[model samples]
Target: MKTINTNIAYKEEGTGEVLLLIHGFCGSSGYWGKVIPMLSEKYRVIAIDLPGHGESKALDSVKDIEQYALVLKDFLEELGIEKVTMFGHSLGGYITLGFAEKYNQYLRGFSLIHSTGFPDSEEAKKGRIASADKIEKAGIDIFIDGLVPKLFAPENVESHKQSMEEVKKIGYEVQPQGAKNALLAMKNRKDRTEILEKTELPVLLIAGESDQLIPADKTFTASGENIKQVVIEGAGHMSMYEAPEELGNAILTYLNHG
Candidate 1:
């Protein structure tokens, strides 16, 4: 069901150890729809719409992913949830890292799906600035149409056309200001690779075998024994849509054994 806590909107289902799902840029709790039912069969799944996206209100003065992490702490406290195995996709992963850095007590473990803990390379920062400008000049729809298709592996683009559209539909709902703000937050995010590599807490790193946006090399940076990396075949950055079952199973295996 949909609920609001501390102004954050979320979808909660099933019951057991909480498994929190956080979606990427231009996404909401809806991005987890395909995998939630499958994973929720064995665990309580809570998917949140980050501020400024989905149904959540935007933080007008939001400066970085760290602020979003603070919002999440308040959100979880409001719900009386003390711990969760957080799984973050794309931009969501950055916020997760911030949480891990500042609030380890709140996480049992965490996963970064199709995301990296490294700071934005100069090239990426430039791209982010350009994207923000595009959102301001042309609005969300135009930018989303051009961006979503590139998230999929080239081979899956034609085959998963419907799923692509669904993603776009979700992207279209992102408030323009929210999208632009998210870009700025991401561009300013710091490198959290140390948290991923050195944390004693169990960590799961999932990479889409053919993700054009973030390759496996970037996602599998942690060499510590505490980290587990899985690459979903026939998938890209949008594995939640391209390979939900595989993605869900990877998470289950990690949770079961970690």
Candidate 2:
């Protein structure tokens, strides 16, 4: 585990070909905590906290998804990671798509977990602007409370109260500016379905059967011939946490087959 000067905080463990794990928006390297130990046994895992999240310094200018991708690219270059197998969740998945677009030769494969390749709908874009404005004005406290319930399944909220609370705490601690920047970037992200269509790189599309944010149907629509889709049953948007073992096995299986 190390913090690089690029304002990117990462944890590196085990050994083998590099596997970079990128967390979603409002998420940090912490999200990969459960899966890292298991993954480390097979591959050297580098879990990163995107700028403005976790231990990373907040950035003053990260207005779009490409900027996020550039930050990731810089982090890898700084570490001398020339080629990698990437596993990106949600917003991280979007960043992976951007990375593949610009640096496909540097990648062996990439996975999109509980994420989408479609651009934001007009309404979704409007909501993002409104959310960003609200975060800027009302602050993050209210936003954190309002967001937690929507992030997980109702069963988790009821049965896994402590885990849910920890997630909320992380969201609460997030820098408002970072959250705002992420929303702005997500709002402006281009439709990346064509990247999947054009690339020959192997892709693993991991979806939660009950994901509210990105439906299973949408995953199929976005997937191309080169993709292997894995749907985790009894999981929601937070599939990594909800079914870490299953997700880890799926990832390992993909890597093995590759």
Most lDDT-accurate candidate: 1
**In model 2, which regions exceed 4 Å deviation?**
222-225
lDDT of 1: 0.92
List where candidate 1 sits over 4 angstroms from the true fold: none
Model 2 C-alpha lDDT per residue in residues 20-138, reported as the tens digit of each score = 99988888888888899989997999999888888887898776888888898888899998999999999999999999998787799999998888899999999999998888888
TM-scores for all candidates: the values are: 0.98, 0.96
Tens-place lDDT per residue, model 1, 1-258, is 465656788999899999989999999999999999988888999999988788987778666898888988888888899999999999999999999999999999999999999999999999999999999899899999999999999999999999999999989989888888899899999999999878999999999999999999999988777889899999999999999999989999999999
Candidate 2 backbone clash number: 0
Over all chains combined, what TM-score does candidate 1 have? 0.98
